[model samples]
Target: MGMTEKQLKSSNKPDKEMPLVQYENVTKKFGDVEVLKGLDLEIKQGEKVALIGPSGSGKTTIIRMLMTLEKPSGGVISLNGEPLWHKKIGDKLVPADEKHLRKLRSDIGMVFQHFNLFPHMTILRNVTEAPIHVLGLSKEEANERAVDMLNKVGLGDKLDAYPEQLSGGQKQRVAIARAVVMHPKVMLFDEVTSALDPELVGEVLQVIRDLAKETDMAMILVTHEMDFARDIADRVVFLHNGQIEEEGHPEDIFETPESERLQGFLSRFLNT
Candidate 1:
């Protein structure tokens, strides 16, 4: 892991820069069930990755941890080389406060599978609300940014529409627009397209592909779309039973997976 410019600038020490995101010896448990087992991962800036595996294999868990919606039971995580849970105060690693957590989360955006939009707010409001409330942008400034993002997602004309008024694909796009308007450095998608109708999946994937090509923001997507993972991900990780069974370039994971577990998993999905 390496340090980002933002982290470096915040530190007085020249040698303390850290990786964009790092999980070292991380573990998560739910009573008797261990969801992650001493997992270690390092994602540099601008990497596009897809996580795939069988059901209950901890793909979504990984994404949630990155979003800090779930804390690790053990180990440490860092973003941009700075500790997300531990901050350096006079050379001491002290526990982080809620204020720091909120700031840390501002750099990460998440798109849930359910498209969690405000039904009462119009499409524009749904996208603009966070920027106004969380980022402290003025209403007009937030609206302008929201409209531009909506236009980017090809929903310019639907600003006045409600989430219920739009199709499944449209709602997902608006959800995406809401996520990106904050200009997050890392976007975590937890099966963003899984809930959509078969026909609506393509539109969401196309927008994602466009974003992948146009931005330097890193993306970690948990998806069941095998073909999209094969084609769009710079790297693909396959998890099984709370561990990463295989990880490599898309072609390597798809055409030449190194693990029997991955081979079996893909065979079922590919042949389905």
Candidate 2:
């Protein structure tokens, strides 16, 4: 599929001096278990970073924290250089109010491992609902934007179809369309292709690759697909024990990992 006019016009140009997302001394704990331990990370505008790790290595937790599904036990997350979990109250930082958090979170969008679609709504309606309500666009405007987004994901003909009518791959594409309709500055993809069959994973990954090429959104993906990560991500981060064990360009990380933990993790897939 050819890039849409909107995609053609989209630029990946980003401000080099400022990071689009920052995790500063971020920590998360549940009871006595620390899921994330004083981790720091940064994603520049238009950068694609993939988080890869063994199970329980805290890859998914990082994405969840960015989406505000979970709160940090310590430290701060910043979006566009402003605090995401806290609000400035006359030079003092305080936990953000609900209103403030919602406003700040509007710039982010997430896609989950499971396709979270409204079963009762048509594909088009599923995509349009958020823009109409959260973005306050008129119904007509939302519909137009939704249609364009669906087409971008190669689902223009499925607009009238319900969730059950689509295959697993198609449903995931619809989910991607729904998220893209909001035009989020940063997109969080948490094991997006993990739930699909082997044959179905390619189509969803293709959509993501196109998004990376066509738009400038900063994308953070937690994925097990090593080849896909190498192909799409500018940087690959291997997380272990709630921290970044090693990070570098895809070629460097995949070819010559310095950490024994990362080498062991990669060998499971690479040697196979």
Candidate 3:
């Protein structure tokens, strides 16, 4: 989607009254282990927020629920002000069926810690597969979209390369290109750099930064890159024990954390 002047301007100042994504008192559990506890968060169109904390802090769970990869044990998740996991029938909100879930999942894109590419497919085919099958785009249209996105992510030269032939960073960039080609309204990054070598992280992050600037896509990153988070996120949230310990503007959260939990987390996370 080519951005007109108005669309570009909208990314800079997203409206707040109607949130594009909302999680109200959300909870999740595996057996008796609770992963998310009464979580509440709101994200607006074109906004970028980073979630940071120690291992098992519920950051990934939040996005997984939104992506419809995992259902919440309780509470409601809404996308564009409509219930995500349930549908309204008359006056009651009922559990959503497969059709509802599949349609909602199409509106969001997610990149996991691993590249998750198909070893059997070429780079260009990898990027084009979802659009052709899921979105029902014509083969020519999907190929056109894939080629343009591959060029943007600096993988145009490697179109015929297989996943096993590419470096880790290149694979992740392909993953980004694949997700972005679909024009998702929301993008989820779950520790995208965690599986990469130190030297490879910057290139992937740079691609994300460019996307953040170019599109009005709302982004939520579960990341450990303190500097990257500071530079990219409009807001930073610190989570602990499945709850938000504290949250604020990146500067406030990083520079002068008011809560002991966040302060300790930063000190330990950054120094390690």
TM-score of each: 0.91, 0.93, 0.93
Q: Of models 1 and 3, which has the larger TM-score?
A: 3
Q: How accurate is candidate 1 locally (lDDT)?
A: 0.86
In order of TM-score, best first, we have 3, 2, 1
Local accuracy by lDDT, each model: 0.86, 0.89, 0.90
lDDT of 1 by residue, 1-272 (tens): 34333323333344443457888777899788999987777666877889999988888988898898888787778898777877789988787888888878888999999998899999999999999998999999999999988999999999999999999899999999999999999999999998999999999999999998999999999999999887778778888888877787888788987689999999999788
| lDDT of model number 2 | 0.89
Candidate 3 lDDT by residue in tens digits, 175-233 = 99989988899999999999999999999999999999999999999999999999999
lDDT agreement of model 3 with the native: 0.90
Which residue pairs clash within candidate 1? 1-19, 2-18, 2-19, 3-18, 18-81, 20-80
TM-score of 2: 0.93
- Number of clashes found in candidate 2: 0
Taking the tens digit of each residue's C-alpha lDDT, what string does model 2 give over 1-272? 23233222222454357889988888999899998888778788888999999988899999898889999899989999999989998999999888888987899999989989999999999999999999999999999999998998899999999999999999999999998889999999999999999999999999999999999999999999999999999988899989878887888889998899989999999878
CA displacement after TM-score superposition, residue 16 of candidate 3 (Å): 5.4
How does residue 47 of candidate 2 score in lDDT? 87
Tally clashes: model 3: 0
How many steric overlaps are in each model, in order?
A: 6, 0, 0
